[model samples]
Target: MDPLLILMLLAMGAFGGFAAGLLGIGGGMILVPFITMVLTARGVPETLVVHMAIATSLATIMFTSLSSVRAHHRHGAVLWRVVQLLAPGIVAGSMIGPWIGKQMDASTLAWFFGAFVAFSATQMLVNKKPAAARDLPGTGGMFAAGGLIGTLAGLVGAGGGFVSVPFMTWCGVRIHHAVATSAALGFPIALAGTVANVFYGWGEPGLPDYSLGFVYMPALLIIVAASVATAPLGARTAHKMPVRRLQKVFAVILYALAAYMFWRAA
Candidate 1:
């Protein structure tokens, strides 16, 4: 990749990292479209662009999630109880997500990405309906939701925030705790996703050099370094302000990105 392009990706990484810190999101809404555009502009093979972006983005998230999770944990925002409650399901699902992804074609993965982005936009646009706390689902539902969301995250290279937040919120977890716990959930999402990308791409023919599975290492390096650099700032901001309002603003941004993804994928 060109040096200039690498620089731009680095910038995007910083911005995405900041957003992850501020919003408890994995920065997928920002990262994926930017990566797709970058790879497409460079005339990478049409079939490879989505796969590359998804894989590379997930690879970056492997680090970014840790940064944001740590930041949130430091602020006492992370709901460790919830993380524990969800861990078994999340781990089991996270493991399976990648295997299922290996069975999916690249284009199918892109479309899956598109639909999820659109769904996230729609969900973000809605008003909150606070459910009773007692209604929070137990082990079975946790496993089911975790597995499905994890698979989608692996397939699409997302941080799983788009699904995890709303699901937890609806399960009677408070909004603040839901977002905080979702930040932690990103860890499993990223780890599972990165691993899956490797499996799916493993032994496949004709991938770009320095790529394993769908990941492009040069881009991964730039994005992760920059994102981690800026995430703490975002985390501080989140702690000092009303994040729900921030989330609304971010949701509009997600809506726009969803539109862009539709246009590009079309």
Candidate 2:
């Protein structure tokens, strides 16, 4: 890869990592479209670009989530119990999601990604609280919710924070706690999703050089290195800032990205 391209990857990682720490997101939403654009520009087949981007994004999230979680843990914000409740279903759903994603055409996946992102952005902008505050759900309910989060995250190459944080907040968890917990949840989602993607794409044709199944190693390494360093910084910032305001800004960015994806898909 050109040194310029490497620098661009690093830049993307830095931005994504900062967002992850600040918002308790896995930064997959930010990474996926950018990675897809880059890969497509490099002459990768359209049919395979989105999968490779998503897989590589998930791979990077494994490291970014760990770094963000550690920072959140330092603040005693992570809810380990919630993580435990959600893990089993999240793992199961994540493992299956990439397999399903692989079967979709690139245009279809792009449309889905765009629509889902737009919805998330709307939710963030609305910032509507639930009509009635309730405690966290029963184990069965949590498991089912986790499954949904993991499956969506896997398909879109997200960290599951957009769904998890909002759901937790709606259930009466504090926003900070919800964000922190979402960071923890990202690890399992990314790990399982990445493993599934690797296996699912193994022996598939037309993958670019330096790929391990669907993952593009060069982009992964560069992004991970930059993201890990920046993630802690973002977490620190999150602790000092107004979270609601930050969320709104993040939502606006998501809307813009969604528009870009929609255009690309069309």
Candidate 3:
């Protein structure tokens, strides 16, 4: 591997990790598109690029989420009850997400990813507050919401924060708590997504060396190492930033990433 490529992967991990901590995302929104770029440049088959990117991005979240949640826990911001309620559904949805993804062509999948990311960004940019009387739904409702969040996140290789954060806030959870809890949710999403992606992608032709199904081991290891290092820093920063400001900035970034995915699809 080229030293330059190594540096690029490391940098991606750092940025992704920071974003994860800062925004409660699993950093897949940032990592997926960029990973596509890297894999493309490395002469990976175009057909496999997006799938690998999504899989590798999700895998990294497994590590980044731990580092991020620890920081949030330190701040006493994590909502463990919420995590408990959502995890089961998230895992179930995550397991199926890759199977759906496997049925789609790469271009179609890219378009779907772009569309959802744009929607998520718009929601963040709008930053609408729900009615004061509104509150989190019952256990059944939460399971349904978690299932949806996990499915979409698995499809796009994200941490599910795009959906979870807004949903929590809409239900009257504070922005900080929402962010922390979302970070906590990333682990289950990543774990289930990773396993599913690997299974779905297993034995696919034209995979590069060091590949485990759709996951590129080299990229996964590098990104995880780098991301975990920076995640704590991002988590700390999230506490200091104004919620509205953070949302705006993150929204803009997501929009840019969405545009990139669209371009890739084209």
By lDDT, the best candidate is 3
Q: Per-residue CA lDDT of candidate 2, range 71-187, in tens?
A: 999999999999999999899889878988988999899899899889988887898855437888999999999999999999999999888887898888888888889999999
Q: Candidate 2: misplaced stretches above 4 Å? A: none
Q: Which sections of candidate 3 miss by over 4 Å?
A: none
Every model's TM-score: 0.89, 0.96, 0.95
- Order the candidate numbers by lDDT, best to worst: 3, 2, 1
Q: Model 3, residue 247: displacement in angstroms?
A: 3.9
| Residue 81 miss distance in model 2 (angstroms) | 0.7
How far residue 106's Cα lies from its native spot in candidate 3, in Å, is 0.5
Please identify which of the two predictions, 1 or 2, would achieve the higher lDDT against the true structure: 2
lDDT of each: 0.77, 0.90, 0.91
Task: Give the range of the ten consecutive residues with the poorest summed lDDT in model 1.
Answer: 127-136
Q: Give the TM-score of candidate 1.
A: 0.89
lDDT tens digits, residues 1-266, model 1?
78889889989999899888877778877788889888887777777787778778878877888888887888687888677766666666666666665566666766677777777766766755546555667777777788777766766777777777777877777766676788788887787678767877776666777777778887889899999989778888877887667667777877777677777666
Q: Which pairs in model 1 have colliding backbones?
A: 201-213
